[model samples]
Target: MISVEEAKRLILENTHVLDPVEVNLEESLGLVLAEDITSPLDLPAFTNSAMDGYALRSYDTEGAHEGFPAFLRIMGIIKAGDTANYELKNGEAIKVMTGAPVPPGADAVVMVEHTEVQEETLVVKKEIKPGENIRYKGEEIRRGDVALLKGTVITPASIGFLTELNVKRVRVYRKPKISLVVTGEELLAPDEEPKPGKIRDTNSVTLKFALSREPTEVISVDRVRDRKSAIEEKVERALRESDVVVVTGGVSTGDYDYVREVLESLGVRSIFWKVLQKPGGPLFFGRKDLTTVFGLPGNPASTLVCFYEYVLPSIRIMLGKNNKFPVEVDALVSEEIRKKADNKTHFLRGYIQGDGKHLHVKLAGPQGSHMLRSFALSNCLIVVPPDVTYLAPGSPVKVHLLPEVFL
Candidate 1:
C-alpha cells in the first residue's frame, strides 16, 4: 500500500488534459476554457442611459435645485432599443428610459425622480454633472480585450458575459467520458426486494449521482455478477469505450474477488493497489493506454470517498482544472476523537456548524465503511493524518467540503 499523497501524485502524473473542442456557448457551462476569450465587440455597444431620466447638456442644469429649477422643452421620448437619432440643442432635454441610447450633444442625465415632467417641459431639480447616469461604450469591456482567461471555469455569469460579447462558441477542454461497472453476486437491484443473504445495490446509484456532480459523461453503468468471465468482459468493454472506468467491488482479497486479476489480464499496469487510508484502503488505480481505471471498494461510503479523493481529481485534471481536489478548510473539532495509531489516514464524515465567528466540525454519525446514512448527512470529511492517535475537543483539523455541499 502507498501513502495517500503518493497515490494522488501518481494519478496526476499519469493523467493528461483532454484536447480542446469548440462548443456552443450554451454548452460550455461548468467547463474549463482552453483558450482566452477576447471580446468581439464593446459591451453596451453604445452610450446609453443607466436610469429612467432626461438626457440633456450638463450646462443646461447647472445651479439647478428643487428651490429654483431649470425648465427645458422635452424633445421626444426614447425607450430602450429605440434609435436615438435626435440631437439635443440648448435648453432641450430628451426623456430617455433605462438602457436607451442617449441623444447626441447630451452630456448628462438627471433621474426622473429628481425632476418632474410638466406638459412637455422638463424640470431639472438637481444639478447634474457631465457623464452622469450614462453607461459608455466599451466601459466594461473594450473590443479585443481579454474578457476571460484560459483555465477559467465557465459559470452562468460567464455565459451571459460571453453572449454580451457576441461569442457564439467557446474553446473548452472536453469533458471526460466515464463508465461504471458494479460487480457483486449478492447485490440486488434497488427496485427488487432484498433477500436474507442479498442487499440492495447502492454503489451503482450512489456512484452515478456522485459522478454527475462533475463535468463528465457517464456513458454506461453496468452491473455484473461476481464471475471472472463476466467481470473481464465488462471491464474490457468499459476500458475500450471510456476515458475513465470505475469498478466497484471484486478488488479486495476474497474467494470471488477477480477485478485486479482481470485488469492485469487485460494489460492494465497497476500504478497502485491500495492506499493507507481509513474507510477505503482496498482501492485500485491503473492505466491502460489512454484510459484510467479505478477499482473502488464495494462499501457505499468507501466508494464515494475514493471517488472524491482519487477519481474526481483525475477527471478534473483531464478537464484542465487548476484545483483538482475538494475545497479544504480549517475547523475545530467539536468532540474528542480516539483511535489506534495505525499508520493510515482517516476520513470521518462530519457536519460543520458555525457560531458566527468560527467553524466547528462534528461527526455526523457512525464511521462505518458500509454506512450510507452518515455519509448522506455529512457536508464535509474531517481528515486525520496517520501519526495522530487522539484529537482533543477544539483541536484544529483540515476538513474537505463535499461536492454536494457547495451545490
Candidate 2:
C-alpha cells in the first residue's frame, strides 16, 4: 500500500531512457530529439531588401525635405532573386523589389509608392534616414551558431525554421514500437454489440488511442483469455516484437487476476503491485530484457488514470525524453466536497475555471470507475490525499490537468 508519490518515485527511479536513432525531418514531429542541432550556414545567407523601394546612398537624400523633392536617376531594377549589379552612387538609385539583395554603397531606401518613376528619373516625396529599410544579413541567425538545441521537440513553427535553414533530414529519437494487449473472457470489442455475458474490451483499443497521441508505432493488439499460460505466451510474443507492452486486466488479487503470475513466468522483474491512487490501484510493472510491461486495471477510469500518470511517462522514456511529462498544479476548490476516506488516495474528475485571477475547480461528473461518460467530459483530476477531511470552497487541492474539452 505505497502512496502515489512513492509509487511514482519508484517507477521513475527504476526505468531507463531508451537508445537514440536518426530519423528524417518529415517524420520528426512529436518525436524527441536524440541530439542537438546547429545551423550550418547563416539563416539568410546574404543581405536582402525588406521592402520594395529604391536603393540609394543616404547622402543623395540628405538635403531633400518634404516640401523640397529630391530627384535622382533610376539606373537599374532588381527583383527578388536578381542581385543589383550596379552599386548605388551619389544621386543615383536602383529599383528594388521585396527580398532583393541590397547593393553596396546604399544606406537607405525610399518606397516605390513614395517615389515617382518619371521615365529614367525618380522623384522622392520625403527624406529618409540611413539603413531605414535594409535587412542585415544573418539578422535571424548567425553562421556557425546553434539554431536549435538538442532535445527540443520539433513543432510546426520549428519545422518552418528548420526548413529555412535547409535541414532536410533530422536526427531525432526513434519512436517506440508498442503492443497493446487485453486479457479477459467477458470482454468484447467496441465494434461488436455486447452480448448478455460479454462487455466491451475497450482497454487495449482506448489505450492505443491514448498512446498514439505521440509518434509511437503500435505493432498490434492481441486479445488473450485470463488463463496464466495464454497471457504468458502473448506477453512473451509482444515483448519480443515491441519496445514496450501494455496489458489490461488480470493484475489484481482476484482468481482471474493472473497477469503478474504470467509476467513472473516470463522471467520479468516485477517493480510493484499497487499504488495509493484511486481509479487505478492495482498497477503491475516489470522489466523483461529491454522491453517494459505495464498491467493496468480493467475499469475504464482506472485504465485512463494509469495511462496518464504512469504509462505516458514510460512511453516518454521509450521515446527518449528526460524531463518531458504531464504538468500538475494546485487548484482552489469552488465548493466543499467530501467522501469516505480510504487507505488509498482518491482522484475525482473536475472542471477548472479562471476568473481573471486564481483558478477554481468544480466536480466534472461522477467518481465511479465504470463511468466513462464522466471521465470523457472531465478536464482535470481533484487529487485528494489520505486522512484529509472534506474539501471546502477555496481550499487548495492538488490537480492533474487534462486536455480541455467540454460538451
Candidate 3:
C-alpha cells in the first residue's frame, strides 16, 4: 500500500490529457478552454446611449437652469435598434432610448427627468457635460483582444460574456467517455425483490448520480457476475472502447477477485494497487495507453470515498484542469474519537457546523466501511492522519468538504 499523496501523484503522472476539440459555444458549459479566445469584434460595436434621454451637443445644455431653461427643436426619436441617420444641428435634440446609437454631432445626453417635453421641443433644465451617459465603442473589449485565456473554465457568466462577443464556437478539451462495470454475482438491481444473501446494487447508481456534475459522458454501465470469464469479457470491452473504466468490487485478495488479474492480462500497467486509507484500502489504478481504469471497493461508503479521493482527481487531470483535488477546509472536531494503532489513515463522515471564527464538526453516524447511512448525512470527511490515534473535542483537523452533486 502507498500513502494517499503518493497514490495521487502516480495517478496524475500516468494520465494523458484528452486532445482539444472545437465545440459549439452553446454546448461548452463546464468545459475548460484549450486555446486563448480573442474577440472577433469590438464589444458594443458602436457608441450608444446608456440611458433613455435626449442626445444633443454639450453646448446646448450649458447655461440651462431650472428657472431659466433652454429650448431646442426635436429632430426625431431614436429608439433602441434603430439606425440614427439624422444629425443633431445647433439648438436641436434627438429623443434617444437606452442602447440606441447616439446621432452624429451629439456629444452629450440630458436625462429626461431633468427636462420637460414641450410641443415639438425639449426644455433642458440642467447642464450636461460631454461624453455623459454614452457607452463608447471598444471601451470594454477591442477587436482581436484576448477575451478569455486558455484553461479558463466556462461558466454561466463566461457563456454570457462569449455570447455578447458573438463567439460561435471554442476549442476545449473533450470530455472523457466513462464506462462503469459493477462486479459481483450476489448483487441485485434496485427493482428486484430482496433475497436472503443478495443485496441491491448501490455502487453503480450512486456513482452515476455522483458523476453527473463532472464533465464526462457515461457510455455504458454493466454488471458482471463474479466469474473470471465474465469479468474479463466486460472489462476487456470497456478498456477497448472507453477513455476511462471504473470497476467496483473484486479488487481485494479474495478467491473470486479477478479485476486486478484481468487488467494485467489486458496489458494495463499498474500505477498503484492500494492506498493506506480506511474504508478503501483496496483502491486500484491502472493505465493502458491513454485509457485509465479504476478498481474501487465493493461497499457503498468505501466506493464513494475512493471515488472522491482517487478516481475524481484522475478525471480532472484528463480534462486539463489545474486543481485536481476536492476543496479542503480547516475545521474543529466537536466530539472525542479513538482508534487503534494501524498503518492506514482514517476518514470519518462528518457534518460541519458554525460559520464564523471556526467550523465545528461532529461524526455523522457510524464509521464502519459498509455503512451508507452515515455518508448520507455527511457533507465532509474529517481527516485523521495515519500517526494519530486519539482525537479530543476542539482538536484541529483537515476536512475535505464534499461537493453537492446530482441535486
* lDDT to native, each model: 0.93, 0.82, 0.90
Per-residue CA lDDT of model 2 for 297-353, tens digit only, reads 989889988888888887787676765456677789998889776866888888887
Model 3 lDDT tens row, 1-407: 89988988888788877999999999888889999999999988999999999999998877889998999999889999999999789999999999999999999888889989889989999888999999888999999999999999999999999999999899999999999999998899878997999998999999998888788898999988898899989888999899999999999999999889989999988888889999899999988988999999999999999998888888888888887888888888899978778967888898987767888888999998889999999999888999999999989999888876111
Q: Give the TM-score of candidate 3.
A: 0.92
Q: For candidate 1, report its TM-score.
A: 0.97
lDDT of 1 by residue, 249-282 (tens): 9999999999999999999999999899998999
What are the per-model numbers of colliding residue pairs?
0, 2, 0
Compute each candidate's TM-score over C-alphas.
0.97, 0.92, 0.92
- Residue pairs with backbone overlap in model 2: 36-150, 188-201
Instruction: Give stretches of model 2 more than 4 Å off.
Output: 63-65, 111-127, 403-407
Sorted by TM-score (best first), the order is: 1, 3, 2
Best-to-worst order by lDDT is 1, 3, 2
